[model samples]
Target: MRRRRLRALLGAALTAAIAVPLVAVAGDASAATNSFRGVNWADARDNYVNGWVIPSGLTAADSYSTVYTKANGIIAGFQSLLGANTVRLPINPQSVNDTWWASYKGAFDSALAHGMKVIVSYWEADTAKDGYVDDPAAWNTMWDRVTTDYAGNANVYFEPMNEPFGYSLSAWVSLCSTWLSRHANIPRGRVLISGTGYNDNVTGVGAASALSGTLLSLHFYGFWASDTTRAAWTTNLSNRLGSYSSRTVIDEAGSPMTTGLTYTGAANQDGNVFTSYFAATTDLTRARQMGIVYWPGLRTGDTYSITRQSGSGLAVNNASGVAQLRWGWGL
Candidate 1:
């Protein structure tokens, strides 16, 4: 997730960008887009750290074997309780090049072993959280190493970066083009180009023919709007998607699941801020058959977390949230 302060500035840029529409290139999107029924497993400090990142409930002290064991259990909970078939995780240059990667790969291996599609996304470090890549050399090195490691793994997908809000559309597109050309070994279908700003809109990237074969990642939040009805929210989302729904995956859409808000029924959703947003977004996902991944499936201290750690096990924080999520997946 991106910081709200950043959103305040970038949101205006997004509005201006939207004022001038990009022509959507009409083509068939891979059916794989809808096949992802997933959730993000985020770090407690929000995945942007000064050094190595440790996912919530995981310690840097853990060995490879321990990470594998813990990740397996958490993944099992996602499958049995929420019916998730995919998981999105964060990575940074520091985490990838350091020794922690040896142990972190255990989590990916465990998830894949359990038949989960893993999306490993890059997150900028907090020391320079200006929404741009911290270091071009380090960033490219991280991707080179990561792509080399997972080139042969069909279950593992690579997302260039998470919420790249600093670069202009042309500059961001140029970076993505460079990335695609550099790592030609990985299949384009396995690469996800994030939306223009804060991963908020896909129309710009969708129009780029160079990025045609790749999937698009989008993020939405209830706090971004005050639409009272499902229809209004749907319009807001559709405007951003702009004929790219077939190829787009809502990789990060969430609300407060642990706040005792009901997620079912029109009466419960209509006037309420959180419920209305979720209802409209999920309803649209089901309609479009687009892939939708809820934000922070398990993040310590996050009220939006759908699952919580119970002793050594994992449990649902809100049954209704899971129900609505599954409904979006058409489960």
Candidate 2:
């Protein structure tokens, strides 16, 4: 009788072990299917060829001022032409003390007005005493304020920091985790963690996994000086990051080095090099990993501005560049 009872107990334990795995597998499959459900621009036709740059200013009323209206119009025009659904705006944490919020608020409002998604970046400053890196408490406060102001708004994404290279990988991971934990009240899928490398390549999957539900962001600007370098970088990145297979986005990328000059002369040639590099990178297999955001749509003093020269009459002559972006890749 004792031997028979032990056998039955062992059999019951074995059955439960098998059942547990089956149930766990089913749950994982279910979760995978729902991973990207309801995320904005997830199924959009175009690969995310979003643009980034500083707005002309934060103040001018729509349709009234030349500078502000033109800045707003340029972005609106791009969305109309390209069906771009996202825009990345870098927010200097130090500038929050001044009218930076007011200046950018209009642009953010305009993006919403035109049905475009907004990704706000918290950038570090060189000399500022109160930037995001300078004060942890202030950073949290700013995040709270922004989220409170724009909470429940559609298609708005938050990036806690922009290219936090000075901090160790572990430190960055910790900082991002803390920020997300503190803002648990914010709507889900609104905050993203961005890293910088050759192409925003994350150093460790462990670090990436720490981000619970936020998007993984990266920046890639292969040698802006030459197309060959750009191509190599793109291929390297694709190979390195292809295996992760997580929800990723190229938050900033472009080839031609922008110097706040006319679109013609040496600048035009450099821009073409960038365009060709983009074309080559998109053709690679890794391009399928996630969305690609082109850099600097209308801002000057950046390498990836796509709009025409600020005061020069020369129209942005890269129609093919724009066309390639619209036709290539999936966001």
Candidate 3:
């Protein structure tokens, strides 16, 4: 997740109203972007680990059955509490290409068993948080195993890498193209190529003929700018997408959910930055008919986490945050 970076607003205010028709255009076999009503299930450690990754609420010593049961409850809470139909999880070389993988599959299997779509994304280890793949050989090997296991599962999606800021725009596109070539058996519709620069922009990747049929990933946050208006926030996100909104998924948009910010009523009039940001994001995503996966749906200690561990189960930390998310999903 691109935590904080303040940049100037792109241009003069664009209209808050998105004039695009809500007609559902089919980009891939999956139908439309709205089909993915999702939330990111991030590790409490922020998914940037030096060793094996374990999502919050799951221990390193848990068995396959234990992982399954635990993941099922969390996934169930996501669905029941937030109307989420998809869960995006993080993976790494250590997490996927080790003995722990046997038990980890249980989490993936349980999500699939619940009829929820799973987006498995790669996160660079913290030892080298430079946004480049740590080791090409190990990276490919990890993907080889991951794609081999889930290539046949229609509900599973693969993201090449998360926020690859280390590569230039051209280099990132080249890397994504290489990934597509390596895993050609996986349908292009099932692959999500992240935008260049912390997954912030998708126009370059979307226009690449080599990545035509693939989906795009975008991450937008309120802290990226000091824009205080709904129109500015909407324009900020729209500028990053360009003409690829149809194939783009705003998979990592979030703000402070537990800080007692009201998401209801006139958002522009709220005056709080987070309220305006959340309102503009949800409204714009809904207007564009795009998929939105909130960041850190269950990350412990994160104020942005919408849900928290309540005993053995999960409880919502912010009902209004979820309501705004559901509104974006058009639920």
Model 1, C-alpha of 326: deviation from truth (Å): 0.5
Off by over 4 Å in 3: 1-31, 267-270
Runs in model 1 lying further than 4 Å from the true structure: 1-9, 18-24
Worst 10 residues of 3 by lDDT: 7-16
Backbone atom clashes (below 3 Å) for every candidate: 0, 5, 0
Q: Give TM-scores for every candidate, taking all chains together and pairing residue i with residue i.
A: 0.96, 0.68, 0.91
Report lDDT per candidate.
0.86, 0.48, 0.82
Tens-place lDDT per residue, model 3, 64-179, is 99999999899999989998999999899999899889999988999999999999999888778777899989999999999999999999999999877777666777788899
**Candidate 2: segments with Cα more than 4 A from true spot:** 1-54, 57-71, 128-132, 196-199, 203-207, 224-231, 240-242, 257-276, 284-289, 301-303, 309-315, 329-331
Clashes of 2: 5
Best by TM-score: 1
TM-score of 2: 0.68
Model 3 error, position 250 (Å): 0.8
User: Which pairs, if any, clash in model 2?
Assistant: 47-330, 47-331, 48-331, 58-103, 258-303
